[model samples]
Target: MLAMNYRGPYRVRAETMPDPVIEHPNDAIVKVLRSCICGSDLHLYHGLVPDTRVGTTFGHEFVGEVIEVGSTVQNLKLGDRVIVPFNVFCGTCYFCQRELYGNCHNTNPQATAVGGIYGYSHTAGGYAGGQAQFVRVPFADVGPTKIPDELLLEDAVMLTDAFPTGYQAAEMGDIREGDTVVVFGAGPVGIFAAKSAWLMGAGRVIVVDHVEYRLEFVRGFAQCETVDFKSVKDMALHIKKMTDWLGADVCIDCVGCEAAGSALQHLTGVKLKLQGGSATALHWAINSVRKGGNVSIVGVYGPTFNAVPIGNAVNKGLTLRMNQASVKRHLPRLIEHIQAGRIEPHRVISHVMPLEEVADAYHLFSSKLDGCIKTVLIPPGVTA
Candidate 1:
């Protein structure tokens, strides 16, 4: 099997690797058909996340066909086409029972903070991801869902992470009727969050990013206003002015640790590694929302602390909510939205390449070249 091998920071390649086999009674072996390079994957590519061991695969958003299943895996079988969520969790644990799948206690060694994440790093449980020909799926019954007959493979792969994550960001906003919502970052998750805000009764939606292509894309996709923060002298003040000086009702920080804005934040967060990741977006979210409003965060960040505006948040009485999306918990509604043509997930896809070209795929996405919004990796046996 050929898998994406992590050599070091800013380096990944397609290398020959042993095929995965069922290792546990609940484990299943999936032959990956369609997999995506998520925005969060950039953290691993840039070596931002801790404990990302070399030679480990890095992918969590994938859909595949089941080739083998262990004795205890009853929910799935050979030949089943499924979309596996990014989370690797046991369904019966306390957090899982409460639908907090991302914090499942039974799957990860570092279970105090985050549960096992496929291909993330050792800190999230050193489970290999699906950026290859085959992947081992633990607790298969609880995570993999059969792709709906009406859904496209492109959309199914996105549902594994981007869509559910974006939707969860909106859900956390607690948006009220006629509220104004502003989402920072115009990546796929931000795009979906902006669109989902409309579904949740937000009267207005605004997406912020410095990339002109992304801003233009989200404006059409989410039917929302756009803000190029690079053009504004004071981004928070701009948002306040857009919201009639009170500030937005809900502000979402979809840009996590790798966020680029001020030179100071970039130097301290990215270059110095003093903070977990850049907290620029978080700073804006905390300072730009109306008093007593909500701030929803779905951006991926490391476990370490980053410089944040706690004093401003406390003074404004903001409700801050954040967590990894429980993908399974939101699939049904998202599937309905996709089937009904309300949200077209595949429209965001800008690049698709073979699995063997994983190296180039990473470069394209990481560099943000070719107007690349999303990239999908198709295995050898899979058709485009």
Candidate 2:
């Protein structure tokens, strides 16, 4: 088997690796049909995430078929088309009982510190992720979901991460019907955040990103307004003026640290603040919200501390909820939406390449070249 390995900063290669097997009773193995290149995966490539191996399998978003199952896996079966949740978690843990599946204590080795994530880092579960032909899945009954045959693989691919994550950010942020919502970062997650804001019944969904292509892509969705942050110094005022000075009711930050291209923009200086204030999407979202509005953040962060504006949050009586997706809780509902064709998350994908060309795809996605909004790496023989 060949896997994309994180060799060092800005270095990743498609390298041959041993095949994975079920190491636990709750484990299942899926033959990856379509995997993705995520913004967070760039963290591993850049060597920003600590404890990850130089050559750990490196992707988190995917859809695939269940080729094998474990003793405890009752609900899932062989030949089932499924979406692999980015996180590997035991269903019966203390945090799992509270629906915080990402923080599950049993599966992840670093469970004492935080939740475990696939293809994320050693700090997570260190589970080899789905950036290749086959991936080991833990807690299959609770982890993977079977999709309808009528639904496309690409549709299910999104459920694994971006789509649900974008929606989860808004859900945790307390987005409501007819409320004005502003989402920062028009990247994949940001676009999903904007779509979820509208689906959750936000009166107006406003998106912020400097990329012309991304903001333009958001236009296909109904009832959306967008802003290029590079054009505005005072983002809050810009949003307020667009909203007739009413401000938004909820704001979501989906960009995390890597906005536009790389989170280490200041360190890399390659793009020169590629997305500008998008680096502080949270700060802008908090400022753009109405006095009592809610702010939700869903971007993946490095294991470090950065100064957040507590003063404004305290003074305005803002409600804040920020974290990774509770995939167990969010996945089922998203699956239903997919079955009904209420939303087509696949619209965000701009390219689909064969699995063998994984290395080329990564370079394009990292460089943000060729108008690459999203790229899905299909298995070599995947038939259209």
Model 1, residue 222: distance off in Å is: 0.4
**Candidate 1 clash total?**
1
After aligning candidate 1 to the native by TM-score, how far in Å is the CA of 44 from where it should be? 0.6
Model 2, residue 315: distance off in Å is 0.9
Global fold similarity of model 2 (TM-score):
0.92
lDDT of 1 by residue, 146-215 (tens): 9988789999998999999999999999999999999999999999999999999999999999999999
Candidate 1 Cα misplacement greater than 4 A, ranges: none
Question: How accurate locally, in lDDT, is each candidate?
Answer: 0.92, 0.79
Q: What TM-score would you give candidate 1 relative to the actual structure?
A: 0.99
TM-score of each: 0.99, 0.92
Question: Across residues 1-384, which tens digit of lDDT does each residue of candidate 2 receive?
Answer: 867777777777777888889988888898889899988887666555668787788788988889888888899889998888887777888988898888888877664745778888788878888888888888888888788778888888888888888888878778767888888887788888888777777887888888788888887753488788888878889888887786788888887765543256444422332332234677787888888889888876665554467899999999998877877688778878877777888888899887777778888887878889999887655664
Error of 1 at 231 (Å): 0.6
The residue pairs in collision within model 1 are 257-278
